[model samples]
Target chain A: MSKTKNFAVVLSAVVLVCCGALILGQKVNAAGEGKITGTVKLDGTAPHMKGIDMGKDPFCSKAHATDPGKMETYVVGSGGGLENVVLYITEGLTGPAASQTATTEPVFDQKNCMYTPHVLALDVDQKFKVTTSDQTTHNIHPLPNPMTGNIPWNQSQPPGAAPVEKSWKAPEVIPVQCNIHPWMHGWFVVVKGPYATSDSNGAYTINNVPPGSYTVTAWHEAAGTQTQKVTVAAGGSGSANFTFKAK
Target chain B: MQRNNLRKWSSVFGAAAVVAFAMPSSAQQTKYDFETRMNIESHVGNITGHAKDAKPDYRRYCVGCHGELGDGNGENFPWVDPKPRNFQLGVFKCRSTPTGTLPTDQDLFDSIGRGFDRSNMPQWSTFTKQERTDLVAWVKHFSPRWVGEKPGTPITIPPEPEVTPERIKAGREVFARVQCWKCHGVLGQGDGPSAATLTDDLGRPIAPFNFAEGARPKCGDTDKDIYRIFMTGLDGTPMPSFADNIKPDEAWDLVFYLRTLMSQHSKEKAMAKQLGLKPVDPNAPAGQQ
Candidate 1:
């Protein structure tokens, strides 16, 4: 009976060791994950963004009566900081690190007849939301090339309507627009790996990237895209700064 | 005449060569691949549809409008106003399924029979049922989507309630709540504020359906058809599905209210007339309808 007990104890210890190693393996992966940070700036004089005429919709015009709305084609901040630029690691990411879908949902709002955060970056298959805060009706239409495997969809959100939750099946730079307000335009930048969008200050940080050398790409709606090579050490961060010339 | 015919033949071959070379390799559908796709099949009721069977019929009738590639770039493409549907995209209006999803085989079959009103596509009711089903299969084979994905589940439609004055009033409220007037005018005249600026997915200018014009909707004319139209939405157009915001019971009410906007006489229209219903004031604050 004592011999049998000893054998059982040995087997249990072996199993526990395997479990501990597996847990440690996962923890090591999490600990080894780093981040990429960057700032995107406009190199030359900022182009003139045309003023939008919201006179067609009485509700929209009234909301922007005080400070007239202008097209967001190029929203350059102080110091030539470019806003609404999406950056992502386009190369070197593979396996779980590349295919991981974000769990946290991002909100894309329609406020004052304009899209809040004009460009939303998302990991492929990450759930995102479309919400309308304005009083008037807005139809949220995202046109993704069907050939790319991401289908296009259109939905209306009247005042007080519930939010619509959706996710992209593939990586694409889908254009989102409000048909009711033609001037209302935005983009959904979907990539397979971790991504980030530059804020008003042209600052962005892409987290959860495993240590590796990668080619990071930064895309702007009007100015097009730029890429730079970056390398992150274990538990350290890499950086790639982009400068787009004003067209 | 012989020299002219020879030149025409050469030009046709030249154009074909240009098309083959110019298109992106990813989008190209080689003749061999297209022929292999003929094996694709669709099931409608108990009838089986084979894409191979519809080739001759498509060449005879559909090739003039739908094109050889099913890209809707046929010889008549330039003259047609609202352009033929690009089947390569697999995005269709009048789907029983929700927006962004493929329509069921039955939906495609029904559309073949319904024949869009005010459109060049004539009613194919003259064709045998088998021919129509085969055509549906042929349509499916054009897009690679059919091979990878199944049709979306059709939305469940509750049994339509009898039309009553209260229902009509409630339907009007539903219409106002959803702000259908943003595109389809308050009076459903297709002259809403945004109507002039409306465009399809292809960026082509498209006009919203004017109920007051006395023309049947491009989808269908029955009460159920009306219900499906708003619930599923006419994809590829400015019209969007209200399924997310609308409850099934409320959707029926909106359908009844939409009927009153049409010039045709109906129970809902008669009840609306008796009630002396006025158009919802677009200026009224939301929920005041």
Candidate 2:
């Protein structure tokens, strides 16, 4: 395995193998597949939510620093900015059922009144295209439980229309609240695999996965769940990380 | 000179842990080194009135607030708006099994070894069931990372039943006569020897987790998220909850020596070699996302 460890294992298998990353002798339903890339890194540290009166808001005194509501760095070290966090891939991950030139799901957005992505992970089935640019109205809750409870859908985005898509069968973690902005929250992890989405710098990637044995999870609507365990060694490539603790 | 008297008693214990994390919390109120379990029959686990039997100083009197090494931090954990409790992300708000499931090791040993009287964490039966199975194997040793540069420690080693071969060489001599090699080093590998001066809560350093970098931490091989981490102790960090004093087959042989101290590292082998693909094993499950 030399030639620089086979190009350091082919540049960590093409910049972190995605598309359901699998590979041991190749057979999770192998057809020349295996992938998962990484990068959901927001640098680190930012918690800020504890009885947030933040002296009665301005986006809670610019994303809050203290009023018993601490958690700085809306800028320093860089924390929370990318609104719709949906790094998807459902069970054995390869891709499909996201038609629209290969965009099966995950594009949910809302820009400002909070929820630009307090974290949203996806995988099972797909379909979730929400949109709102803001003029108020808000409320598009989607709190899935009973593993996707008949896809517990909700809507209200109002403002400028044209962005509503929906779909999800099971997996869990969807609590997209905004009863007209009761602190406008968000979270939607679902996961099965073939994931990515971590910007404003947290970084994420998941592609073409076919190799197998996964347990790769990393979630954070507020900050929780950060699993790991990957093998994908047929054509070979693997690396996983998730740190969240800075609320 | 035990290394200059343990480096002057770890620089006076790192200036008393940075003056107990710079005081406040109403003047530094926290301490539960281990021991809490109450009488043993004040609960029954969600049948309404009989479920509180796991307490063991829940990893120093209940993990900071109620997180997985009981989940709650990230500075102060967005101040707990129904957040906190990563019981290795099994998820629970007070379950019967419907809000996304995952709560029964008796509904997490009766809501953290029986306490919840309006919550922020209380009632840790006086500690035992082996300090709530050593604070449920130190709240599944807060997710083991580190691979080669060495990491994955505090300890999550459960799973050793069957015995023989002189009790698996006396359980590797009860794992170095239970110093677990001073914070799991030698081979359980989180770098032990007190892991080159630990650190975390922002001091940095912090290293441990190295079962050959294969980390898959939900930190629960099950048994009700390892008995709700030996009956609740992850409210914040140092991880302590052995639910009265270990048992349930010694919390499953300390979760198989903390899953052999997770040889550490595997965000799906670093996102399958960072997008280039093919290292995949993630325990052999197939692909589909």
TM-score of each: 0.89, 0.23
lDDT score, candidate 2: 0.43
Superposition-based RMSD of candidate 2 using all C-alpha atoms, in angstroms: 28.4
**How far in Å is the alpha carbon of B260 misplaced in model 1?**
1.3
Candidate 1, superposed: residue stretches over 4 Å from native = A1-27, B1-36
In candidate 2, position A90 carries an lDDT of 34
Model 1 DockQ (Cα-based): 0.20
State the lDDT at B62 in candidate 1. Answer: 92
Off by over 4 Å in 2: A1-247, B1-46, B49-101, B105-107, B114-123, B126-162, B170-183, B187-289
Tens-digit lDDT string for candidate 2 (A1-247): 2353454444434423422232222333356455555555544455443443423223334543433343222322354333234455433433331211223666767755555555656555666687767543343555454222323333344345567666665457766664333455566666554566666655556665556667666555544446677767655656675555444
Q: What DockQ does each prediction reach against the true complex? A: 0.20, 0.01
Tens-digit lDDT track of model 1 for A107-137: 9999999999788998888999898898888
List interface RMSDs for the candidates, in order.
Answer: 21.8, 27.5
Best by DockQ: 1
* Candidate with the greatest lDDT versus the true structure: 1
